[model samples]
Target: MVENAASATGPSIATRIGKLDLPAPTLMGSGCYGSGEEYAPFVDLAGIGGIVLKSVTRFPRLGNAPPRLVATPSGLLNAIGLQNPGIDAYLENDVAKFAERPCAVIGSVAGFSVDDYAYVTERLAARDEIDAIELNISCPNVGSEGETFACDPGLAEQATRAARRVTAKTLIVKLSPNVTDIAAIARVVEAAGADALAVVNTVRGMAIDVETAKPRLGNTTGGLSGAAIRPIAVLAVWEVARAVKIPIVGQGGIENARDALEFILAGASAVSIGTGNFTDPRAPQTVADGLRSYLAERRIASLRDVVGKANPGFAGVR
Candidate 1:
Protein backbone atom coordinates (compact mmCIF):
# COMPACT_ATOMS: atom_id res chain seq x y z
CA MET A 1 0.00 0.00 0.00
CA VAL A 2 1.24 3.49 -0.83
CA GLU A 3 1.92 5.45 2.34
CA ASN A 4 1.69 9.18 2.84
CA ALA A 5 5.15 10.69 2.74
CA ALA A 6 3.94 13.27 5.21
CA SER A 7 2.77 10.52 7.56
CA ALA A 8 6.30 9.27 8.13
CA THR A 9 8.02 12.61 8.73
CA GLY A 10 6.53 15.67 7.10
CA PRO A 11 4.29 18.64 7.81
CA SER A 12 1.10 18.05 9.73
CA ILE A 13 -2.22 17.42 7.92
CA ALA A 14 -3.55 20.23 10.04
CA THR A 15 -3.92 23.13 7.64
CA ARG A 16 -5.75 26.44 7.56
CA ILE A 17 -9.35 26.71 6.39
CA GLY A 18 -9.54 30.46 6.11
CA LYS A 19 -8.04 31.60 9.44
CA LEU A 20 -8.95 28.41 11.30
CA ASP A 21 -6.22 25.80 11.16
CA LEU A 22 -7.81 22.34 10.99
CA PRO A 23 -6.17 19.09 12.21
CA ALA A 24 -6.28 17.22 8.90
CA PRO A 25 -7.20 17.39 5.21
CA THR A 26 -10.28 15.24 5.80
CA LEU A 27 -13.51 16.86 7.08
CA MET A 28 -17.03 15.40 7.16
CA GLY A 29 -19.29 17.32 4.82
CA SER A 30 -22.74 18.57 5.77
CA GLY A 31 -25.43 15.86 5.66
CA CYS A 32 -22.96 13.00 5.64
CA TYR A 33 -23.08 11.39 9.10
CA GLY A 34 -26.31 12.97 10.27
CA SER A 35 -25.96 13.87 14.00
CA GLY A 36 -23.10 12.47 16.07
CA GLU A 37 -25.56 9.89 17.40
CA GLU A 38 -25.27 7.62 14.34
CA TYR A 39 -21.53 8.03 13.68
CA ALA A 40 -20.16 7.52 17.22
CA PRO A 41 -20.91 3.79 17.07
CA PHE A 42 -18.99 3.27 13.83
CA VAL A 43 -15.87 5.35 14.34
CA ASP A 44 -14.16 7.47 16.97
CA LEU A 45 -15.44 10.97 16.28
CA ALA A 46 -12.43 12.39 18.04
CA GLY A 47 -10.03 10.73 15.65
CA ILE A 48 -11.45 12.52 12.62
CA GLY A 49 -10.33 16.06 11.91
CA GLY A 50 -13.78 17.66 11.79
CA ILE A 51 -17.52 17.05 11.36
CA VAL A 52 -20.05 19.26 9.54
CA LEU A 53 -23.48 18.68 10.98
CA LYS A 54 -26.59 18.02 8.92
CA SER A 55 -28.15 21.11 7.36
CA VAL A 56 -30.24 23.06 9.85
CA THR A 57 -32.98 25.40 8.72
CA ARG A 58 -34.54 28.39 10.45
CA PHE A 59 -37.60 26.26 11.10
CA PRO A 60 -38.16 22.53 11.24
CA ARG A 61 -38.44 20.85 7.83
CA LEU A 62 -40.35 17.73 6.85
CA GLY A 63 -37.94 16.96 4.00
CA ASN A 64 -39.35 15.09 1.01
CA ALA A 65 -41.68 12.12 0.63
CA PRO A 66 -40.67 8.47 0.59
CA PRO A 67 -38.48 6.80 -2.10
CA ARG A 68 -36.20 9.72 -1.49
CA LEU A 69 -33.04 7.83 -2.31
CA VAL A 70 -32.24 5.45 -5.17
CA ALA A 71 -28.91 3.91 -6.10
CA THR A 72 -27.53 4.76 -9.52
CA PRO A 73 -24.60 3.20 -11.36
CA SER A 74 -21.81 4.37 -9.07
CA GLY A 75 -23.71 6.87 -6.96
CA LEU A 76 -27.14 7.74 -5.56
CA LEU A 77 -29.83 10.34 -6.05
CA ASN A 78 -31.82 11.99 -3.32
CA ALA A 79 -34.20 14.90 -3.02
CA ILE A 80 -34.10 15.15 0.76
CA GLY A 81 -35.39 18.66 1.03
CA LEU A 82 -33.35 20.07 3.89
CA GLN A 83 -35.03 17.92 6.50
CA ASN A 84 -33.96 18.92 9.99
CA PRO A 85 -35.31 19.42 13.51
CA GLY A 86 -34.91 23.23 13.30
CA ILE A 87 -32.10 25.34 14.72
CA ASP A 88 -33.38 25.66 18.26
CA ALA A 89 -33.89 21.93 18.65
CA TYR A 90 -30.54 21.20 17.06
CA LEU A 91 -28.68 23.57 19.37
CA GLU A 92 -30.48 22.24 22.40
CA ASN A 93 -30.16 18.59 21.48
CA ASP A 94 -27.50 17.81 18.89
CA VAL A 95 -24.97 20.66 18.84
CA ALA A 96 -23.83 20.19 22.41
CA LYS A 97 -23.14 16.49 21.95
CA PHE A 98 -20.97 17.07 18.86
CA ALA A 99 -19.19 20.01 20.46
CA GLU A 100 -17.81 17.58 23.01
CA ARG A 101 -16.05 15.59 20.28
CA PRO A 102 -12.28 15.89 19.74
CA CYS A 103 -12.45 17.58 16.32
CA ALA A 104 -13.99 20.86 15.27
CA VAL A 105 -17.75 21.13 14.79
CA ILE A 106 -18.95 22.98 11.70
CA GLY A 107 -22.65 23.78 11.55
CA SER A 108 -24.41 23.77 8.19
CA VAL A 109 -27.09 26.45 8.09
CA ALA A 110 -29.81 26.95 5.46
CA GLY A 111 -32.50 29.57 4.98
CA PHE A 112 -35.04 30.73 2.43
CA SER A 113 -34.34 34.42 2.88
CA VAL A 114 -31.63 36.80 4.02
CA ASP A 115 -33.33 37.18 7.38
CA ASP A 116 -33.46 33.45 7.81
CA TYR A 117 -29.79 33.16 6.99
CA ALA A 118 -28.88 35.91 9.41
CA TYR A 119 -31.01 34.46 12.17
CA VAL A 120 -29.59 30.96 11.83
CA THR A 121 -26.03 32.22 11.50
CA GLU A 122 -26.46 34.50 14.52
CA ARG A 123 -27.70 31.64 16.65
CA LEU A 124 -24.80 29.40 15.66
CA ALA A 125 -22.30 32.23 16.10
CA ALA A 126 -23.29 32.81 19.74
CA ARG A 127 -22.24 29.26 20.55
CA ASP A 128 -18.65 28.37 21.35
CA GLU A 129 -19.25 24.83 20.13
CA ILE A 130 -19.53 25.65 16.46
CA ASP A 131 -16.11 26.03 14.84
CA ALA A 132 -17.54 27.24 11.52
CA ILE A 133 -20.75 27.63 9.48
CA GLU A 134 -21.39 26.34 5.97
CA LEU A 135 -24.17 28.30 4.27
CA ASN A 136 -26.44 26.08 2.15
CA ILE A 137 -27.80 28.37 -0.53
CA SER A 138 -27.61 25.94 -3.40
CA CYS A 139 -30.16 23.26 -2.65
CA PRO A 140 -32.00 22.74 -5.92
CA ASN A 141 -35.03 20.90 -4.62
CA VAL A 142 -36.10 23.50 -2.06
CA GLY A 143 -39.27 25.56 -2.61
CA SER A 144 -37.68 28.87 -1.68
CA GLU A 145 -35.18 31.08 -3.52
CA GLY A 146 -32.11 28.95 -2.71
CA GLU A 147 -31.62 27.85 -6.29
CA THR A 148 -32.03 31.40 -7.59
CA PHE A 149 -29.66 32.84 -5.01
CA ALA A 150 -26.93 30.39 -5.97
CA CYS A 151 -27.35 30.90 -9.70
CA ASP A 152 -27.20 34.67 -9.64
CA PRO A 153 -23.83 36.08 -8.67
CA GLY A 154 -25.38 39.21 -7.21
CA LEU A 155 -27.79 37.25 -5.06
CA ALA A 156 -25.07 34.86 -3.94
CA GLU A 157 -22.92 37.84 -2.92
CA GLN A 158 -25.77 39.56 -1.07
CA ALA A 159 -26.69 36.44 0.87
CA THR A 160 -23.11 35.63 1.82
CA ARG A 161 -22.41 39.21 2.88
CA ALA A 162 -25.54 39.20 5.03
CA ALA A 163 -24.46 36.01 6.79
CA ARG A 164 -20.94 37.34 7.28
CA ARG A 165 -22.32 40.30 9.19
CA VAL A 166 -23.59 38.15 12.05
CA THR A 167 -20.89 35.53 12.53
CA ALA A 168 -17.27 35.95 13.54
CA LYS A 169 -16.76 32.22 12.98
CA THR A 170 -15.40 30.84 9.75
CA LEU A 171 -18.04 30.94 6.99
CA ILE A 172 -17.99 28.72 3.91
CA VAL A 173 -20.42 29.25 1.03
CA LYS A 174 -21.41 26.04 -0.73
CA LEU A 175 -21.76 26.67 -4.49
CA SER A 176 -24.16 25.15 -7.02
CA PRO A 177 -23.03 23.36 -10.15
CA ASN A 178 -26.11 24.39 -12.15
CA VAL A 179 -24.75 27.87 -12.64
CA THR A 180 -23.61 29.05 -16.06
CA ASP A 181 -20.22 30.08 -14.77
CA ILE A 182 -19.05 28.72 -11.45
CA ALA A 183 -15.91 30.87 -11.34
CA ALA A 184 -17.99 34.02 -11.58
CA ILE A 185 -20.08 32.93 -8.61
CA ALA A 186 -16.97 31.94 -6.65
CA ARG A 187 -15.51 35.41 -7.11
CA VAL A 188 -18.70 36.99 -5.82
CA VAL A 189 -18.76 34.90 -2.66
CA GLU A 190 -15.05 35.46 -1.96
CA ALA A 191 -15.48 39.20 -2.33
CA ALA A 192 -18.46 39.05 0.01
CA GLY A 193 -16.19 37.80 2.81
CA ALA A 194 -16.72 34.07 2.58
CA ASP A 195 -13.81 32.32 4.29
CA ALA A 196 -13.91 29.28 2.03
CA LEU A 197 -15.88 27.66 -0.81
CA ALA A 198 -17.33 24.13 -1.07
CA VAL A 199 -17.21 23.58 -4.77
CA VAL A 200 -20.10 21.93 -6.65
CA ASN A 201 -23.01 20.62 -4.70
CA THR A 202 -24.75 17.56 -6.22
CA VAL A 203 -25.83 18.09 -9.82
CA ARG A 204 -29.58 18.13 -10.39
CA GLY A 205 -30.96 14.94 -11.99
CA MET A 206 -33.96 12.65 -12.21
CA ALA A 207 -34.66 8.93 -12.59
CA ILE A 208 -37.84 7.32 -13.87
CA ASP A 209 -39.58 4.06 -13.04
CA VAL A 210 -40.01 2.64 -16.50
CA GLU A 211 -42.65 0.09 -15.57
CA THR A 212 -44.87 2.54 -13.70
CA ALA A 213 -43.95 5.41 -16.02
CA LYS A 214 -43.43 7.63 -12.99
CA PRO A 215 -40.57 9.46 -11.35
CA ARG A 216 -38.43 7.24 -9.16
CA LEU A 217 -38.12 9.76 -6.34
CA GLY A 218 -41.21 11.32 -4.82
CA ASN A 219 -39.60 14.65 -5.49
CA THR A 220 -39.34 14.78 -9.27
CA THR A 221 -35.71 15.84 -9.25
CA GLY A 222 -32.87 14.87 -6.92
CA GLY A 223 -29.26 15.76 -6.44
CA LEU A 224 -26.68 13.34 -7.87
CA SER A 225 -23.70 12.32 -5.76
CA GLY A 226 -21.08 9.54 -5.74
CA ALA A 227 -18.20 8.16 -7.81
CA ALA A 228 -20.06 9.05 -10.99
CA ILE A 229 -19.72 12.77 -10.40
CA ARG A 230 -16.06 12.72 -9.41
CA PRO A 231 -14.74 14.07 -12.69
CA ILE A 232 -17.29 16.86 -12.80
CA ALA A 233 -16.62 17.75 -9.19
CA VAL A 234 -12.90 17.76 -9.86
CA LEU A 235 -13.37 20.15 -12.78
CA ALA A 236 -15.57 22.43 -10.71
CA VAL A 237 -13.03 22.48 -7.89
CA TRP A 238 -10.26 23.30 -10.30
CA GLU A 239 -12.21 26.23 -11.72
CA VAL A 240 -13.32 27.66 -8.38
CA ALA A 241 -9.92 27.20 -6.78
CA ARG A 242 -8.29 29.11 -9.60
CA ALA A 243 -10.92 31.86 -9.50
CA VAL A 244 -10.58 32.55 -5.80
CA LYS A 245 -7.60 32.51 -3.46
CA ILE A 246 -9.56 31.12 -0.52
CA PRO A 247 -9.54 27.48 0.56
CA ILE A 248 -11.63 25.00 -1.44
CA VAL A 249 -13.37 21.93 0.07
CA GLY A 250 -13.79 19.61 -2.89
CA GLN A 251 -16.35 16.79 -2.75
CA GLY A 252 -18.35 14.52 -5.07
CA GLY A 253 -18.08 10.74 -5.50
CA ILE A 254 -14.92 10.33 -3.42
CA GLU A 255 -14.96 6.53 -2.86
CA ASN A 256 -11.28 6.03 -1.99
CA ALA A 257 -8.06 7.76 -1.02
CA ARG A 258 -6.98 8.01 -4.66
CA ASP A 259 -10.23 9.79 -5.47
CA ALA A 260 -9.58 12.17 -2.61
CA LEU A 261 -6.03 12.69 -3.87
CA GLU A 262 -7.44 13.55 -7.29
CA PHE A 263 -9.39 16.40 -5.74
CA ILE A 264 -6.22 17.59 -3.98
CA LEU A 265 -4.38 17.48 -7.28
CA ALA A 266 -7.29 19.35 -8.85
CA GLY A 267 -6.84 22.23 -6.39
CA ALA A 268 -8.90 21.30 -3.32
CA SER A 269 -7.22 22.19 -0.05
CA ALA A 270 -9.27 19.41 1.56
CA VAL A 271 -11.88 16.79 0.63
CA SER A 272 -15.30 15.74 1.91
CA ILE A 273 -16.88 12.30 1.41
CA GLY A 274 -20.62 12.30 0.72
CA THR A 275 -22.35 9.32 -0.98
CA GLY A 276 -19.31 7.16 -0.46
CA ASN A 277 -20.06 7.17 3.26
CA PHE A 278 -23.28 5.23 2.70
CA THR A 279 -21.53 2.47 0.74
CA ASP A 280 -18.73 2.08 3.27
CA PRO A 281 -19.30 3.49 6.72
CA ARG A 282 -15.53 3.59 7.12
CA ALA A 283 -15.07 5.41 3.79
CA PRO A 284 -13.50 8.53 5.25
CA GLN A 285 -10.89 6.59 7.19
CA THR A 286 -9.97 4.62 4.10
CA VAL A 287 -9.59 7.80 2.10
CA ALA A 288 -7.41 9.34 4.79
CA ASP A 289 -5.29 6.21 4.99
CA GLY A 290 -4.99 6.06 1.21
CA LEU A 291 -3.92 9.69 1.02
CA ARG A 292 -1.13 9.02 3.47
CA SER A 293 0.01 6.07 1.38
CA TYR A 294 -0.09 8.11 -1.84
CA LEU A 295 1.96 10.90 -0.31
CA ALA A 296 4.59 8.50 0.96
CA GLU A 297 4.84 6.85 -2.44
CA ARG A 298 5.20 10.16 -4.25
CA ARG A 299 7.72 11.47 -1.71
CA ILE A 300 5.49 14.49 -1.19
CA ALA A 301 5.94 16.14 2.18
CA SER A 302 2.61 17.88 2.70
CA LEU A 303 -0.95 18.28 1.39
CA ARG A 304 -0.05 21.87 0.67
CA ASP A 305 2.50 20.63 -1.81
CA VAL A 306 -0.24 19.15 -4.01
CA VAL A 307 -3.07 21.65 -3.62
CA GLY A 308 -3.64 23.80 -6.72
CA LYS A 309 -0.95 21.87 -8.58
CA ALA A 310 -3.54 21.21 -11.28
CA ASN A 311 -4.27 24.93 -11.76
CA PRO A 312 -1.31 25.81 -13.95
CA GLY A 313 -2.35 23.42 -16.71
CA PHE A 314 -5.92 24.73 -16.70
CA ALA A 315 -5.02 28.44 -16.87
CA GLY A 316 -5.43 28.50 -20.62
CA VAL A 317 -8.82 26.79 -20.51
CA ARG A 318 -10.27 29.41 -18.18
Candidate 2:
Protein backbone atom coordinates (compact mmCIF):
# COMPACT_ATOMS: atom_id res chain seq x y z
CA MET A 1 0.00 0.00 0.00
CA VAL A 2 1.11 3.61 -0.58
CA GLU A 3 2.11 4.93 2.85
CA ASN A 4 1.65 8.25 4.59
CA ALA A 5 3.82 9.72 7.40
CA ALA A 6 3.41 6.70 9.65
CA SER A 7 3.92 3.37 7.88
CA ALA A 8 1.13 0.86 8.27
CA THR A 9 0.39 -2.20 6.16
CA GLY A 10 -3.24 -2.38 5.14
CA PRO A 11 -5.63 -3.59 2.51
CA SER A 12 -5.25 -2.37 -1.04
CA ILE A 13 -7.31 0.61 -2.22
CA ALA A 14 -8.97 -1.70 -4.77
CA THR A 15 -12.77 -1.37 -4.90
CA ARG A 16 -15.77 -2.65 -6.80
CA ILE A 17 -18.49 -0.42 -8.27
CA GLY A 18 -21.29 -2.47 -9.76
CA LYS A 19 -19.65 -5.10 -11.98
CA LEU A 20 -16.58 -2.95 -12.59
CA ASP A 21 -13.55 -3.52 -10.38
CA LEU A 22 -11.30 -0.49 -10.03
CA PRO A 23 -7.69 -0.57 -8.81
CA ALA A 24 -8.06 3.00 -7.55
CA PRO A 25 -11.16 5.02 -6.72
CA THR A 26 -10.17 7.77 -9.19
CA LEU A 27 -11.14 7.87 -12.88
CA MET A 28 -10.54 10.04 -15.93
CA GLY A 29 -13.82 11.79 -16.59
CA SER A 30 -15.36 11.66 -20.05
CA GLY A 31 -14.35 14.43 -22.46
CA CYS A 32 -11.30 15.41 -20.37
CA TYR A 33 -9.44 12.14 -20.87
CA GLY A 34 -10.41 11.80 -24.56
CA SER A 35 -10.35 8.02 -25.02
CA GLY A 36 -7.29 7.70 -22.72
CA GLU A 37 -4.90 8.55 -25.58
CA GLU A 38 -4.32 12.30 -24.99
CA TYR A 39 -2.85 11.87 -21.49
CA ALA A 40 -1.15 8.48 -21.91
CA PRO A 41 2.19 10.19 -22.54
CA PHE A 42 1.81 12.45 -19.50
CA VAL A 43 0.45 10.00 -16.92
CA ASP A 44 0.58 6.31 -16.09
CA LEU A 45 -2.74 4.71 -17.11
CA ALA A 46 -2.12 1.50 -15.19
CA GLY A 47 -2.74 3.18 -11.82
CA ILE A 48 -6.10 4.91 -12.12
CA GLY A 49 -9.50 3.25 -11.82
CA GLY A 50 -10.78 3.69 -15.38
CA ILE A 51 -11.05 6.05 -18.38
CA VAL A 52 -14.43 7.17 -19.86
CA LEU A 53 -14.46 8.63 -23.34
CA LYS A 54 -16.48 11.55 -24.64
CA SER A 55 -20.08 10.90 -25.68
CA VAL A 56 -20.44 8.83 -28.85
CA THR A 57 -23.60 8.70 -30.91
CA ARG A 58 -25.01 6.46 -33.66
CA PHE A 59 -24.05 9.01 -36.29
CA PRO A 60 -21.33 11.61 -36.58
CA ARG A 61 -22.15 15.03 -35.20
CA LEU A 62 -20.42 18.29 -36.19
CA GLY A 63 -20.51 19.24 -32.48
CA ASN A 64 -21.92 22.74 -32.09
CA ALA A 65 -19.66 25.40 -33.66
CA PRO A 66 -16.53 27.39 -33.02
CA PRO A 67 -16.00 29.47 -29.85
CA ARG A 68 -17.64 26.60 -28.00
CA LEU A 69 -15.38 26.93 -25.00
CA VAL A 70 -14.67 29.72 -22.53
CA ALA A 71 -12.98 29.96 -19.12
CA THR A 72 -15.11 31.09 -16.23
CA PRO A 73 -14.24 32.45 -12.80
CA SER A 74 -14.15 28.90 -11.41
CA GLY A 75 -15.17 26.63 -14.28
CA LEU A 76 -15.35 25.99 -18.02
CA LEU A 77 -18.35 26.48 -20.33
CA ASN A 78 -18.58 24.08 -23.24
CA ALA A 79 -21.07 23.25 -26.00
CA ILE A 80 -19.04 20.65 -27.83
CA GLY A 81 -22.18 18.69 -28.64
CA LEU A 82 -21.31 14.99 -29.01
CA GLN A 83 -18.52 15.06 -31.56
CA ASN A 84 -17.35 11.59 -32.48
CA PRO A 85 -16.79 9.31 -35.48
CA GLY A 86 -20.12 7.63 -34.84
CA ILE A 87 -20.45 4.16 -33.32
CA ASP A 88 -19.30 2.01 -36.24
CA ALA A 89 -16.17 4.06 -36.89
CA TYR A 90 -15.44 4.33 -33.18
CA LEU A 91 -15.64 0.54 -32.77
CA GLU A 92 -13.15 0.23 -35.62
CA ASN A 93 -10.72 2.98 -34.63
CA ASP A 94 -10.88 4.35 -31.06
CA VAL A 95 -11.97 1.29 -29.08
CA ALA A 96 -9.31 -0.77 -30.85
CA LYS A 97 -6.70 1.27 -28.95
CA PHE A 98 -7.88 -0.13 -25.62
CA ALA A 99 -7.50 -3.75 -26.71
CA GLU A 100 -4.15 -3.99 -24.98
CA ARG A 101 -4.51 -1.15 -22.46
CA PRO A 102 -4.65 -3.53 -19.47
CA CYS A 103 -7.04 -1.16 -17.71
CA ALA A 104 -10.75 -0.55 -17.46
CA VAL A 105 -12.17 1.42 -20.41
CA ILE A 106 -15.72 2.79 -20.21
CA GLY A 107 -17.74 4.05 -23.17
CA SER A 108 -20.12 7.02 -22.87
CA VAL A 109 -23.11 6.64 -25.17
CA ALA A 110 -25.47 9.49 -26.04
CA GLY A 111 -28.50 9.58 -28.29
CA PHE A 112 -31.57 11.49 -29.50
CA SER A 113 -34.10 8.78 -28.67
CA VAL A 114 -34.53 5.52 -26.76
CA ASP A 115 -33.69 3.52 -29.88
CA ASP A 116 -30.61 5.62 -30.50
CA TYR A 117 -29.31 4.96 -27.01
CA ALA A 118 -29.97 1.24 -27.40
CA TYR A 119 -28.29 0.96 -30.79
CA VAL A 120 -25.13 2.70 -29.61
CA THR A 121 -25.05 0.76 -26.36
CA GLU A 122 -25.68 -2.53 -28.15
CA ARG A 123 -22.65 -1.96 -30.32
CA LEU A 124 -20.51 -1.00 -27.33
CA ALA A 125 -21.79 -4.00 -25.37
CA ALA A 126 -20.43 -6.37 -28.01
CA ARG A 127 -16.92 -5.02 -27.48
CA ASP A 128 -14.50 -6.77 -25.13
CA GLU A 129 -12.29 -3.73 -24.65
CA ILE A 130 -15.09 -1.80 -22.97
CA ASP A 131 -15.62 -2.86 -19.36
CA ALA A 132 -18.69 -0.70 -18.80
CA ILE A 133 -21.20 1.63 -20.50
CA GLU A 134 -22.30 5.06 -19.22
CA LEU A 135 -25.54 6.37 -20.69
CA ASN A 136 -25.41 10.11 -21.43
CA ILE A 137 -29.13 10.82 -21.58
CA SER A 138 -28.58 14.53 -21.16
CA CYS A 139 -28.90 15.07 -24.90
CA PRO A 140 -32.10 16.54 -26.26
CA ASN A 141 -34.77 14.03 -27.33
CA VAL A 142 -36.20 14.96 -30.69
CA GLY A 143 -39.23 12.84 -29.90
CA SER A 144 -39.95 14.92 -26.83
CA GLU A 145 -39.94 18.52 -27.99
CA GLY A 146 -36.21 19.00 -27.18
CA GLU A 147 -36.46 18.11 -23.51
CA THR A 148 -33.36 16.26 -22.27
CA PHE A 149 -33.86 12.64 -21.25
CA ALA A 150 -32.11 13.19 -17.93
CA CYS A 151 -34.58 15.92 -17.04
CA ASP A 152 -37.57 13.53 -17.12
CA PRO A 153 -37.88 10.44 -14.96
CA GLY A 154 -40.14 8.68 -17.47
CA LEU A 155 -37.81 9.36 -20.37
CA ALA A 156 -34.75 8.45 -18.32
CA GLU A 157 -36.29 5.11 -17.35
CA GLN A 158 -37.31 4.36 -20.95
CA ALA A 159 -33.81 5.10 -22.22
CA THR A 160 -32.20 2.99 -19.50
CA ARG A 161 -34.60 0.10 -20.02
CA ALA A 162 -33.96 0.10 -23.75
CA ALA A 163 -30.22 -0.14 -23.19
CA ARG A 164 -30.58 -2.74 -20.45
CA ARG A 165 -32.56 -5.04 -22.69
CA VAL A 166 -29.65 -5.33 -25.11
CA THR A 167 -26.53 -5.52 -22.96
CA ALA A 168 -25.65 -7.36 -19.80
CA LYS A 169 -22.59 -5.12 -19.51
CA THR A 170 -22.37 -2.77 -16.56
CA LEU A 171 -24.87 0.03 -17.28
CA ILE A 172 -24.06 3.35 -15.58
CA VAL A 173 -26.63 6.09 -16.08
CA LYS A 174 -25.16 9.61 -15.89
CA LEU A 175 -27.80 11.78 -14.18
CA SER A 176 -28.33 15.44 -14.84
CA PRO A 177 -27.94 17.93 -11.98
CA ASN A 178 -30.47 20.33 -13.51
CA VAL A 179 -33.49 18.34 -12.34
CA THR A 180 -35.74 19.51 -9.52
CA ASP A 181 -35.84 16.00 -8.00
CA ILE A 182 -32.65 14.11 -8.76
CA ALA A 183 -33.46 11.41 -6.22
CA ALA A 184 -36.70 10.60 -8.02
CA ILE A 185 -34.80 10.17 -11.27
CA ALA A 186 -32.17 8.02 -9.53
CA ARG A 187 -34.78 5.59 -8.19
CA VAL A 188 -36.49 5.23 -11.56
CA VAL A 189 -33.21 4.44 -13.34
CA GLU A 190 -32.23 1.95 -10.63
CA ALA A 191 -35.60 0.27 -11.03
CA ALA A 192 -35.00 0.22 -14.76
CA GLY A 193 -31.86 -1.93 -14.30
CA ALA A 194 -28.95 0.49 -14.03
CA ASP A 195 -26.05 -1.25 -12.32
CA ALA A 196 -24.57 2.04 -11.16
CA LEU A 197 -25.09 5.78 -11.53
CA ALA A 198 -22.81 8.65 -12.46
CA VAL A 199 -24.23 11.04 -9.86
CA VAL A 200 -24.24 14.12 -12.06
CA ASN A 201 -23.11 15.47 -15.38
CA THR A 202 -22.24 19.15 -16.03
CA VAL A 203 -24.77 21.57 -14.56
CA ARG A 204 -26.75 23.62 -17.07
CA GLY A 205 -25.18 27.06 -17.60
CA MET A 206 -24.53 29.80 -20.12
CA ALA A 207 -22.38 32.93 -20.69
CA ILE A 208 -22.99 35.99 -22.81
CA ASP A 209 -20.72 38.60 -24.41
CA VAL A 210 -21.68 42.04 -23.16
CA GLU A 211 -20.03 43.80 -26.08
CA THR A 212 -21.63 41.82 -28.91
CA ALA A 213 -24.91 41.28 -27.05
CA LYS A 214 -24.67 37.61 -28.03
CA PRO A 215 -24.11 34.31 -26.32
CA ARG A 216 -20.45 33.45 -25.74
CA LEU A 217 -20.82 29.84 -26.80
CA GLY A 218 -21.49 29.09 -30.44
CA ASN A 219 -24.43 26.90 -29.45
CA THR A 220 -25.73 29.80 -27.34
CA THR A 221 -25.80 27.40 -24.39
CA GLY A 222 -23.34 24.98 -22.82
CA GLY A 223 -22.66 22.74 -19.86
CA LEU A 224 -20.84 24.18 -16.86
CA SER A 225 -18.03 22.08 -15.38
CA GLY A 226 -14.95 22.41 -13.10
CA ALA A 227 -14.57 23.80 -9.57
CA ALA A 228 -17.77 25.80 -9.76
CA ILE A 229 -20.07 22.76 -9.50
CA ARG A 230 -18.40 20.46 -6.96
CA PRO A 231 -20.83 21.37 -4.21
CA ILE A 232 -23.82 20.63 -6.44
CA ALA A 233 -22.33 17.34 -7.57
CA VAL A 234 -21.73 16.29 -3.96
CA LEU A 235 -25.28 17.09 -2.99
CA ALA A 236 -26.66 15.16 -5.94
CA VAL A 237 -24.52 12.15 -5.03
CA TRP A 238 -25.71 12.31 -1.43
CA GLU A 239 -29.35 12.34 -2.54
CA VAL A 240 -28.93 9.52 -5.03
CA ALA A 241 -26.96 7.43 -2.54
CA ARG A 242 -29.73 7.71 0.02
CA ALA A 243 -32.37 6.85 -2.58
CA VAL A 244 -30.74 3.84 -4.26
CA LYS A 245 -28.54 0.85 -3.46
CA ILE A 246 -26.42 0.93 -6.60
CA PRO A 247 -22.91 2.43 -6.71
CA ILE A 248 -22.32 6.06 -7.66
CA VAL A 249 -19.55 7.65 -9.74
CA GLY A 250 -19.39 11.24 -8.46
CA GLN A 251 -18.13 13.93 -10.81
CA GLY A 252 -18.26 17.64 -11.69
CA GLY A 253 -15.46 19.92 -10.37
CA ILE A 254 -12.92 17.44 -9.03
CA GLU A 255 -9.40 18.86 -9.48
CA ASN A 256 -7.37 17.03 -6.87
CA ALA A 257 -7.55 14.35 -4.21
CA ARG A 258 -9.18 16.72 -1.71
CA ASP A 259 -12.05 17.37 -4.11
CA ALA A 260 -12.25 13.71 -5.04
CA LEU A 261 -12.16 12.75 -1.36
CA GLU A 262 -14.98 15.13 -0.69
CA PHE A 263 -17.13 13.28 -3.24
CA ILE A 264 -16.17 9.91 -1.79
CA LEU A 265 -17.06 11.04 1.71
CA ALA A 266 -20.35 12.39 0.45
CA GLY A 267 -21.34 9.08 -1.19
CA ALA A 268 -19.34 8.49 -4.37
CA SER A 269 -17.76 5.08 -4.54
CA ALA A 270 -15.52 6.42 -7.31
CA VAL A 271 -14.52 9.99 -8.26
CA SER A 272 -13.90 11.29 -11.78
CA ILE A 273 -11.34 13.97 -12.73
CA GLY A 274 -13.04 16.16 -15.35
CA THR A 275 -11.96 19.67 -16.27
CA GLY A 276 -8.94 19.21 -13.98
CA ASN A 277 -7.15 17.27 -16.72
CA PHE A 278 -6.98 20.35 -18.95
CA THR A 279 -4.88 22.39 -16.49
CA ASP A 280 -2.85 19.39 -15.33
CA PRO A 281 -2.18 16.47 -17.63
CA ARG A 282 -1.35 14.37 -14.59
CA ALA A 283 -4.56 15.11 -12.69
CA PRO A 284 -5.77 11.50 -12.65
CA GLN A 285 -2.54 10.09 -11.28
CA THR A 286 -2.12 12.94 -8.84
CA VAL A 287 -5.61 12.49 -7.43
CA ALA A 288 -5.23 8.70 -7.22
CA ASP A 289 -1.90 9.01 -5.41
CA GLY A 290 -3.26 11.64 -3.09
CA LEU A 291 -6.12 9.27 -2.25
CA ARG A 292 -3.57 6.64 -1.24
CA SER A 293 -1.85 9.12 1.01
CA TYR A 294 -5.22 10.10 2.45
CA LEU A 295 -6.06 6.47 3.24
CA ALA A 296 -2.74 6.15 5.04
CA GLU A 297 -3.21 9.36 7.01
CA ARG A 298 -6.72 8.50 8.10
CA ARG A 299 -5.71 4.85 8.51
CA ILE A 300 -8.69 3.86 6.41
CA ALA A 301 -8.32 0.30 5.17
CA SER A 302 -9.37 0.95 1.58
CA LEU A 303 -11.26 3.36 -0.67
CA ARG A 304 -14.34 1.19 -0.21
CA ASP A 305 -14.12 2.02 3.47
CA VAL A 306 -14.08 5.74 2.79
CA VAL A 307 -16.97 5.73 0.30
CA GLY A 308 -20.03 7.48 1.74
CA LYS A 309 -18.20 7.84 5.06
CA ALA A 310 -20.19 10.95 5.85
CA ASN A 311 -23.57 9.32 5.20
CA PRO A 312 -25.63 7.93 8.02
CA GLY A 313 -24.86 4.25 8.85
CA PHE A 314 -21.93 4.42 6.46
CA ALA A 315 -20.29 1.00 6.20
CA GLY A 316 -17.02 2.09 4.54
CA VAL A 317 -15.57 3.92 7.60
CA ARG A 318 -15.83 2.72 11.16
Off by over 4 Å in 1: 1-11, 313-318
Q: Every model's Cα RMSD, please? A: 3.6, 3.4
Residue 177 local lDDT, model 2: 88
lDDT score at residue 310, model 1, on the 0-100 scale = 64
lDDT of 1 by residue, 92-150 (tens): 98777665677767888888887888899999878888889889889877754667778
Q: Give the TM-scores of the predictions, in the order they appear.
A: 0.93, 0.92
**Window of ten residues with lowest summed lDDT in model 1:** 1-10
